[model samples]
Target: MTITIIGTGFVGVVSSAVFASFGNVVYGLDVDEVKVRSLSEGKVPFFEPELEELVGKSLSKGNLRFTTSYEEAVSQSEIVIIAVGTPSAADGTADLKYVKAATESLAPYLQEKTIVAIKSTVPPGTNRQVEEIISKHTDKEVSVVSLPEFLREGVAVSDTLHADRVVIGATQEWAIEKLLDLHEPLDGERVVMRPESAQMSKYAANAYLAMRITFINQIADLCEKTGADILEVIDGIGFDKRIGRHYWYPGLGYGGSCFPKDVKELAAVSKKLGDENNILVLMDHINEARIPVKLNDFGEKIGGWEGKQVSVLGLSFKPNTTDMREAPSLKVIPYLQEKNAIIKAYDPKAMDEAKKVWPSLFYANDVNEALDQAEVVIVLVEWDEFANLDLGRMKDGGWLIDTRQMYDKKSVESQQLQYLGIGTV
Candidate 1:
């Protein structure tokens, strides 16, 4: 099957790479020529494990190509997958301007009986709008199928190729069959449903995960007051078969490309349709408050931050991706800055990306450099390398605020560092 994926962002890139690796010819289209050219040179635009090798193999085997032209993209493939971004609007509604524009652009080029699968995360009823837009622009029978992507950012390649399940949504039976057939290369159970339901399923999945993260964080907050270990608390309840052990660890609340936006969007959509979304609204509220709450606790621990040389380890929202969207460090760093703390920060990959938001940051070369001469250290993101950081390098009696709870309490206390963490004694 020849496939053309529009909007070569993380979702699009992973799908293109995976589909191409399945021996299907994939044409990844994007308006960014530089990014497309970079991929052509075997350089992945984002940080994802095992993607570079797959993309290289796909290119070497002539199964994958990238271009900036919609005409070329539509001409090369029978199926066009929309993987455009749906960023949040000011009112928390999903901004679908990009999705509409992408669909309109390819309408003229779509051949008869083409399947237009929406891999982008969109609100309900978007598939109908896509169908109307494309059908109005051309007489070609364009099947707008809602095939929302469930790939997590860190493990997007595996999530796509080896997904536990695949949802196919379309109004027509032919569209459903075409999608299921195309996804045969992927190892997953096919879930067939209407477009709106499929769209809701994607939002529901993210919203539920976001809720779990928020719930854990809230529990951590309560646990601290009761002198309870949050980790053990999680272990006690997480072992229950009904409640799985994923997304249960409380950290700098859920921040990445999907959870935050999708949760807000789900609530936004519900409210827009004249329904109450108290749970989702509260989930968003709680996740947003995590950083500020942590900052308040950090300040309370140190008494004041007027002259404290603070070091923040891990600048990215999460590890492995250069994505800093909704990163807790973004909120935490600035909050500390407002409190008059001298800040030094470091991340393995996201330092460059982080610099855009925090240009005033005293960028550190490494974990040791960041910790040097620091009176306080805050582990904002849970980077694996930070788990083994030498706390002995820190000044004696300095503060160690482990927001993600990445370090051992006893080890830090033994080194004369005042250990501070969420929901811990």
Candidate 2:
């Protein structure tokens, strides 16, 4: 099968590379000529661990190629996947202008009855909108389908290769067959459903995960006040067959490209459906509430940082990916700056991206440079390199706060440094 993917963002790039590796001729399309050209040179644009190797292998085999011309890709492929960006709007709805524009651009060139699949995170009824747009411009009978992606940022490549399940939403049986044939090489069950339900499923899954993290963070606050440890409470609760363990670990908060936007988009979708969304509203507020929760905890630990040198390790939303969109570090860093804290931070790959947003922040050359002359160290993001940092180098009277609980308290205490962590004694 000749598969062509539009919008070479994180999802588009990762999915195209995987599809090519599965023995299909894949063409990745993007508006950015520079990015497409970089991929053609076998260089990945983002910092995803091991993606360079996979992209290199696929390129070497002539299975994968990148191009800025959407018309050329659409003319040569049987399966066209729309993996564009659906950024959040001011009204909390997914701004689908980009998705619509991409569909419109390719509508005239969609030769023969090609299967057009949407992998972008869009609001419900978007596939119908896409179908309407395509039918208005072309006489070709296009099979429009909605197949939302559910890959995490850090583990996107692995998740795509070995997905838990594949959801295919189509109106026609042949449309379903086209999608099934595309993913038939994989060994996972295909879930067939209506397009609206498929769209709702993606938002529902992300909102529920956001709610879980918010619930645990709220309880962690209560545990801190009531002299109870949250880890023991969570461990005890996790053993129950009813409540499985995942997304239960308490931390700064949940922040990434999906959870925040999807929750708000779902609430907007519900409002359009004429029903109030209490749970989703609470999830958004609860996730936003952590900005103060984190800053207040830092203030309490460092005794009101006015002119204090604080070192923050990790800037990305999570480990293994250089994505800082809606990351907790952005919220916390600015708050510390308001209190007149001299900030020094380091992340293996996010520094270049972080500098674009936080130009005034002291960019450390490495973990040691970030910690130099620091009165306190805060592990903001759980990057693996930070899990074994040298705590003995911390200045006298300084402390370490493990917000992600990615540290060894015993080892730090043995080195005579005060170690504080969430849900730790």
- Residue-level lDDT of model 1, residues 1-425, one tens digit each, is 88899998888888899989888889999989899999988898778888889999999999899988899889767899999899999999899999999998988889888999998999888988898999788987778889988888777788888898999888788888888888888888899989889999999999988888888888888888898999999889978989966667687788888888999998887787777758998788878877877777778868988779999887777877788888878788888889999989888888888888878778998888888768999888778888888887888899898988788889889898899888788
* Model 2 C-alpha lDDT versus the unseen true structure: 0.86
Clashes of each: 0, 0
| Tens digit per residue, CA lDDT, model 2, 221-283 | 888778788888888888887987656868888888888899888877677777775788767
Lowest-lDDT window of 10 residues in candidate 2? 416-425
TM-scores of all candidate predictions against the true structure: 0.97, 0.96
| Position 110, candidate 1: lDDT | 91
Over 4 Å off, model 2: 272-277, 408-411
Q: How big is the positional error of residue 299 in model 1, measured in Å on the Cα after superposition?
A: 0.5
Q: Against the unseen true structure, what C-alpha lDDT does each candidate score?
A: 0.86, 0.86
Q: Work out candidate 1's RMSD over C-alphas.
A: 1.4
